[model samples]
Target: MAPKQDKKVEEEEDAIYEVEEIVDHRRSKTKHNMVEYLIKWKDYAPEFNTWEKEHNVYSKGLINIYWAKQPYTLTQFKKKTHEGESSIPKKRPASSQATKIDRKQLAQEIKSSQISTSPPTGLVWTDIDAIVNVFHSEPNTYFAEVKWPGGKRNTYIPTRIIKKYNPLKLIYYYESQLEFYLPP
Candidate 1:
């Protein structure tokens, strides 16, 4: 009888009982229920553009979130105090921009980053524009610089070498070994 009651409560709660496997964009130690996080953004963040926390988060934050390509557990994530955050500049990625940046010798650097980072994920893929940007951009660039797309350039990167972050490649996150798929 007690078990039956627990089930009812769980169902009524609309419990998000699963999580998807995804990579941590920040390289930080947080990869719990990435699925729920993205899903929430897709469902409620914005109709077409980025999704920012209307009250807790700021603008351009949503752009950064999508670029991460990670997942989080809805139930577990919501339980937290929800105060952690980072700065959100007033900009979007190169994809959302009109101006284009082209650098020389970017292919080699991206090839290196890919060669070094690829095997772990099994594969990686990217569009021609990103491929061009990676080749044109400098090497070992961080997500923040790239997240803004055309807003802020990664000048720290050597123009002599460039690399791209191909989304097609299958990156293997340590969390992927687990079995959890968020609601469609």
Candidate 2:
């Protein structure tokens, strides 16, 4: 009679462990430099989601399935805190020395390329004008130096949006976003 009761309790514990679905997942690093998945489980409240070690979750096929369902190829994974702020560290302004060097290098590269110095016009400006700089400010993140329809050059536009415009066939079949050229 005691053995039968213990078996029923074990069955109940097994039911609790079953995962119905995976809501979301983010990769995080532990103090020991080990990678883990911060998994948000379906049917469970957000507070109950757990960060399971990568090795443990990978063997169970949970992480792979989650990645397949929602593919995000970006390098960084942003996690939010309880206060609604992002956990990712803010990007520091590029140092003046580094900025100067980058500017010189970019100038030389652009000069050699066939890309026009004038702002793009009409349909091109609306569809494919490239993002020239990105700022840390809220509400507006990208600054595009566009050519107005009338051939006006260096007209800076503050936009909160930008998207990938070109892909390169270099070493890794790499994809590049619209060029971001910081003004001197």
Candidate 3:
């Protein structure tokens, strides 16, 4: 019985030591905080790593030792701190920064402008009348808001199938729409 009790004590000590050495330190970004460190268990894969508060890990003295041993530069630290987000400052929506009257005035200006009715040379108007607005574009695709002669509006038309049409104007128009409508 005495021998068994001694062996059990030894096993508990070994378990404590295992926990001490198993901490693998890494950093991450959280919504509330700009920077955080993820504590990964030595024997576990990266997917199982958990985000731990700096205060909690610092109290244990594990992170201090880890940071001292790692030879990372300032740029690397910034990169780690801002992981999962763009480095560039996001632009706010134009409407949020402008007055309601200004927005109404701008809308009126856009509505009053006369876009050319005739299709560019070699392009046929076909079933549509004129391009009134544009919504989005990608590498090989473009979406436009078109108007018909009867004052009907088609909000989404793919520009790729339109023959002899250059999509630059539509792409520029879409970007402008994003500037006005999208919240950063």
Best by lDDT: 3
lDDT of each: 0.31, 0.42, 0.46
Rank candidates, lDDT, best first.
3, 2, 1
For candidate 1, the 10 contiguous residues with the lowest summed lDDT are 19-28
Q: Model 1: per-residue lDDT, tens digit, 1-184?
A: 9999999898768743222212122211354333222223323323333322323222223433343222332232354422243334333333522222212223344444543322122222231122212222334543211222333222222322223443331122212223444465
Taking all chains together, the TM-score of candidate 1 against the true structure is 0.19
Better of 1 and 2 by TM-score: 2
Query: Model 2: number of clashes?
Result: 1
Candidate 2 error regions (>4 Å) = 1-5, 13-31, 59-184
- Count the clashes in each prediction: 24, 1, 0
Best by TM-score: 2
Error of 1 at 29 (Å): 14
lDDT of 3 by residue, 62-143 (tens): 4433443334422455466534456563433335444444435533443455324344344456545655544233456544
Off by over 4 Å in 3: 1-28, 31-34, 42-47, 58-60, 73-184
Error of 1 at 157 (Å): 24
TM-score of 2: 0.26
TM-score of each: 0.19, 0.26, 0.23
